[model samples]
Target chain A: MDEQRFLEYVQSGGQVETTDRMPDDYRSKLVKFIEMHGNSELMGVLPEREWILRAPTLQRKLALTAKVQDEVGHSQLIYRVVEDLGKPREQCLADLISGKSKFHNVFHYPTKTWGDVGVIAWLVDAAAIISQKALLKCSYAPYARIMKKICWEESFHILHGRDVVLTMMNGTDEQRELVQEALNRWWGPLMQFHGNPISKEDDPMYIWRIKSQGNEEARQQFLDGYVPQIWELGLTVPDPKLRKSDDGVWEYSEPDWDELKHVVTGHGPKTQERLEFRRKFLEQEAWVRSVVLAEAA
Target chain B: MSEKVQKIVEIADDELILGWRDSEWTGIAPSLEEDVAFSSIAQNEIGHARALYELAARELGTDADTLAFDRDPGEYLSAPLVEERRMDWAHTIARHFLYETADEIRLAALKDSDDAEVAGLAAKMDREEQYHRLHARMWRDRLQDEPRFVDALEELWPAAVAVLPEELRPQMSERLQLDLPSNSLLRGFERGSHSEELRPLLDEMTMVRRSVPGATW
Candidate 1:
């Protein structure tokens, strides 16, 4: 089939696997988009993994560890899908560490406290899950299949996050303060987490059906589902204009698109430190990979 | 504390500290698949620590959280082997293989303990340990010929034996085909000793807990 027929097929709910013929644009777009999702999941673990050590309770420690472990697992699953699409996982890691690729804007920031931990799991995972749930209909079959398992594990993370938040919200004034402070810090990135609202027609990812939902649509879903939960705790969101319209659309202040661009381009506060940390391990562990890869060869 | 409580704390502390070290690899392991597999092992160690701490908690009239996070660095009973944060894959895997081997000997002895509760928990823990052992063995076999991996194993072997009691060290050495109770353990961290690595770890491990004293995390 020609480009037009392939486009029509994907737009109308068709799926393609590794061996399927596709337009060059679709293949490259799919590799880049899916690889970024895998990168985001991998980087997302760093902020939370620190808290896994500092978790105040045995239960919280285990929960946080398991949650971070799941993120690593998701990255594994995602990178495998990309590898099948022709990008080796090693190439993906090299590109990520060298700052030649981008992850989600949220992961580029740092995690400050246990409060950041709860807020991330609760809100950040919620935002990610919305995007992931939409990908259940991803035009790429292998990516779509992995999204099923990824979505299932992410639901548990949201609960774990909310549980951490609720426990703090119900505790001492200091504990409550931690949650409020973390929420205040994370609200900005949370808004930007879904990406800028480029038109579906113009966004290559959407045009190819790799992402079944528009960026704005996902943000609206996150607000519609979570703002009430945030409000119920008597916690305030940072935005003054965040509210629901009479027509049921959620409205909020415009996100800093420039900030999003800058951060995703590798200038975020913790990006260098985080990337260096990963590179250190990768270089240190290069021998192990060589041993294993040599055997495979 | 009774001898029983001390012994439980000893093992629990090892698992707690080791798990904390292992988790440092959450996203950065050599391969993504290995990353996930290794992380589960890390989580399992923490889980084992929690269970063992609960048993100790009941005896001490406190709680698992208190035993796990509230203790000072010097108070922890973990061996020196697990105290250091070795992230190198060869060293980490070497430590993993050695630690699991030593733990098998230790757990086996506990299975026949006079205390039924301890023995029962040991049996339960052993069932779960099968996967950890298999994982360690699988990596050992794969990396046996790698020079760095071999160096790591040789360097860490003595430390691994030190993790067991003097009485059990013989059994561990016999299983690994190394000399028993060799004076050459990279350095011995007997049960009562604390490594330089533990304090920095405890500080990070308890930072949030310490920040909001008497509050929920």
Candidate 2:
């Protein structure tokens, strides 16, 4: 099929398999888009993993550990999909370490407190799940199939995060402050989490069916779904403009496009440290990989 | 603490500390499948420790969180094997395989104890230990001929012997398919033999709760 026909097919919700032939440009775009997602999931683990050790209670500890486990699991599934699409997992990891690839803007920031834990799970993951759920219908079958599992696992994280927030909210005043402080710091990143809005017709990810929803649509969905939950607990968002208009569109302070560009391009506060941490672990374990992978089982 | 409560505390500390060490590998293992499988084993070890702590908490008239976090670092009972932070995969796998082997002998002895509570708990723990053994063995097989694996096992073997009761030493040697250590087993790993690492881990782990002490969370 010609480029026009292939575009029509994807726009009409046609699914593509790995074996199916596609245009060079389409394939390249899919690889770039999906590789970034895999990178995000992998980087996302670094922040949350700390909380696994610091969880205040048994149930919270178990839930946080399991939730972090799911994030790693999602990364595994995502990388496998990318590998099947022609890029190897090692190559993906190498590019991530070299800062040659970008992940979501939010992961670059530090997770500072128990409150940050609750905010990340409740708001940050809520934002992510919106985009991930849209990808459940991704044109590439392998990537889409993994989304089903990733989205389901992420649901647990949302509940765990909200539980953390709500419990802290109902506790002592000091506890409540933790949640609010985290919210204040995180709201901007969360607002920018879905990336700057682009029209569906113009976004290449949308046209190629790698993303079934546009940037603005994903952000709005996050707002519509999570804003009430946030406000009901009496926590205020940093942005006064963050509200839904009568027409059902969210009108928020426009996210800092330049900031998103800057952070995701490897200049965020904690990017280098986190990547270096991953690099150190990989380096330390290189012997194990060399031994096991080389062995003829 | 009462004698019974003290025994519970000893084993509970060992399990909890080792579980914490195991969990350090959750995301970054050498392979994706190994990462997931290893995580489950880590979670189970922590789960087992939680269960054991809950039982001990009842006797001590406290809750699991209090038992897990409120203890002084000097009060922990983990063996030196679990306490040493083996971040490298070679050492990690060596400790994993060695500990699982040693634990099989200890759990087997507990499985037949005169105290029904101890026996019942041991039986439950043994079931989970089965998966831990499978996972440890898988790594052992994968890394059998590698020089690093061999060196790690040799370096860690002495501590591995120290993990089990003295009476069970022979059984552990048999289970691991290696000769017993020529030197006497290192002792003094029970409650109150805390690792220096526990102090820091506890400080970070308890920081949130301590910040708002007595709060519901």
Candidate 3:
């Protein structure tokens, strides 16, 4: 199919299969977007996996481990799609660690407390699930199909997150403070999680139908679903201007677009450290893979 | 604690701590396929620990969570082999293979325990360990020729032997097909010795609960 025709096809809700022909730009963009997502899920594990060891209770430990495992599985599914699209998993990893690619902004920050843990699961995951659900209609059929399973698995993460947050809310004043403090620290990054506002027509991801929701729309959805949940627990958002409008738009202090730009471009406080950690582990295990996948006689 | 309860706690602690170590690889294993399969093993270990704890909890008049989190590090009976925070992949896999091998032998003994409760639980846990063994064996075969993996297994061999009762050591040694080292088997550490790692882990793990000491969370 011609480039213009392919664009029209996707715009009109046509699904592109792996076997289908497409413009080089579309395939390249799909790989880049999906690879970054896979990278995000892989890097995301570093911030939370430690908690599995320190999980205060058996139930919490087990639940968190399972959740983290699910994220790993999701990344696996994602990378396989990327691999089929032309980039090898090794090349993707190299690009990720070499600072040639990007991951989501939120994972670049640190997880400071168990309250941070709860916040990540409850609010952060809720925000992510909103975006992921939108991708269920991704024009790339394989990516879209895997998203179905991802969205399904994420349903449990939301429940687990809500349960943790609810439990903390019902607990002592210090516990409640933990959640509030986490929210305060996380609000800026969370606001930027969906990226800065761009018109659907202008945003390539939206234009290509890889991302069905616009950035502002995703942020508003996050607010509509979660802001009330936060308020109900007597927690205050750091932004005073944050409020839902009569027409249902979420009004808030404009996020630090510069900071988002800075962080996503590899200057986040914890970006280098987290990437280095992943790189170190990957290097250490390189021998195992060499031997494991070595030609069987 | 009753005799039966104490015995179960010993085993439960071992499984819980080992599961924690295994779960460390959830997001960062050698491959995605191995990550998923390995994670299921980790979850299964925790599940086995929970079951054993519940059995003990009934006699101790407490619940599983309380037994899991409320205990002082010194009170835990997990072997040092499972408690070391080795992030190195070679050491990690070595310990994994060794522990699964030893655990299978111990579970076999327990499957025949005179106590019906212990025997039944061991039987159930054994079935789950079956998958764990398959995974470990798969990795061991793959990594056997690698120098780093061989070194790791040799270094950790003694510690793996200590994970079981004295009488079962021979069986474990036979399964591992290695000579019993002259090095002293690490013991007594289970109840009194803990890696410095436990304190920090507990700090993060309990941060939320500690913040609201009497609260529901």
**Candidate 2 C-alpha lDDT tens digits along A222-257:** 888888888899888888777778898888887788
Q: Write the per-residue lDDT of candidate 3 for residues A159-205, one digit (tens) a residue.
A: 89888888878877887788899999999999999998988889998
Query: Which pairs clash in model 3?
Result: A167-B217, A171-B215, A171-B216, A172-B212, A175-B211, A175-B212
C-alpha RMSD in Å of predicted model 2 compared with the true structure: 1.8
Chain A TM-score across all models, in listed order:
0.98, 0.97, 0.98
Model 3, B68-144: lDDT tens digits are: 76777778877778887887777887998898888888888888899999999999999888887887887788778
What is the CA-based DockQ of model 1? 0.77
Q: Candidate 1: where are CA atoms >4 Å away? A: B181-188
Interface RMSD of each: 1.2, 1.4, 2.1
- Candidate order (lDDT): 1, 3, 2
Model number 2 iRMSD: 1.4
* Root-mean-square deviation of candidate 1: 1.7
